[model samples]
Target: MVDQSHSFYLTSSLQQKLSKLVLAAFCLFTLYFWPQRFELWLIQVVIAVAICSYFSYTIYRLKSYKSSFTLHSRNLFKFANNPNEFECKVLWVSPLLCAFYVLPNTEVEDQAGKSQLIIVWRDMLSDSNFRHLSRLLLYIRRNQASG
Candidate 1:
């Protein structure tokens, strides 16, 4: 029988997305103005600093995540080097390309502070596994709303 529960490892999609976003920001910023606009150099520098900050955050998240997440019938659990399993709630669900975005339940309005997980469908062992995970998440979400 197919297991209702499964573990998902962090994928490289996160890194790729962050890098692409950084590149896009630089491209957009440069394209917004002409090369002769020397007075607006300050704006370019400010945006560059913002991009650098995002790059640093990306690196930190990638380095700190040394674990996988186990999704069960009722709750999602994270296993890392810390030993103690961390429980998480589904803050949001969306299919981005072939992957799913998940956020831990938090009261904070900003999603950046919440732990996020991206599960890539193509990275799964089989199609059935991916389907099962999807159903499980849907079930849990429904249960949360009813109870």
Candidate 2:
């Protein structure tokens, strides 16, 4: 439903980077100071894995976007070469890290299907594009609420 074309990039602002760094530091500190308990160790491992995965995905998204199609519509579209169109749901929107979501359209059989895609502030979204996205999301929410 969107006419404005926007490109995607693996970018983050200084504020975002600093916030993430602080979070990582806090996790690391906990891992180092917490007592030598098995449960604590497990928690640390999980946190570390999550942190690594997030960073890895960020890099992967950028590289993939380089070769994938550009975002031109507000509806579901392919961001990669994969022959699948994604349906998006706006979970949350913020200046730091907006929670843009997408799910597969072929998951009609699945009972639980949800995927999150985060859009950082430094991404290539222009002011007009962001406004359009926000407006589209609001419209979707309104329709869903009514029906």
Candidate 3:
């Protein structure tokens, strides 16, 4: 692959859909376990209101989130909202997720003690970019493990 930076908008469409589906399933599960007879109608109303509130708030939060990322080779990445592009070390990688340990400052740390692990989700980028990133991350994962 060329040593070019890939700018990605973190819309995460697929992940959002999957999460919504899972949450909807959980709501259904809650309904299944809910009382059969409305003997205590007040308790039923409370349960219903609580579940709906949780579901709505979660959906709102998901929809409101917006971010952009730029990956500049295996060792460097930056958030678009941030001004500086910082050096980060790759921690681990899988098909669906990759973790990067970002140094606290712009440079690499001695012990990496202040490194923060940030997750890059699969759906954060386009299909081609995500695949390219996955390959790069896998390579980094291999090198990190042995070093």
Candidate 3 or 1, higher TM-score: 3
Tell me the spans in candidate 3 whose CA falls farther than 4 Å from its real position. Answer: 1-4, 27-48, 60-65, 84-124
The digit string of per-residue lDDT tens for model 2 on 45-112 reads 88778876786565555443433333444455456555656676667665534555666676655524
Residue 27 miss distance in model 3 (angstroms): 6.3
* Full ranking by TM-score: 3, 2, 1
lDDT of 3 by residue, 29-128 (tens): 6766766786766776777778777777777777666777777655566778766556667776777767777665535445345555766677776768
lDDT of each: 0.56, 0.56, 0.68
Residue pairs with colliding backbones in model 1 are: none
Candidate achieving the largest lDDT: 3
Question: Cα lDDT for residue 116, model 1?
Answer: 50
TM-score of each: 0.52, 0.54, 0.58
Tell me the deviation in Å of residue 79 in model 3. Answer: 0.5
Q: What is the RMSD of candidate 1?
A: 6.3
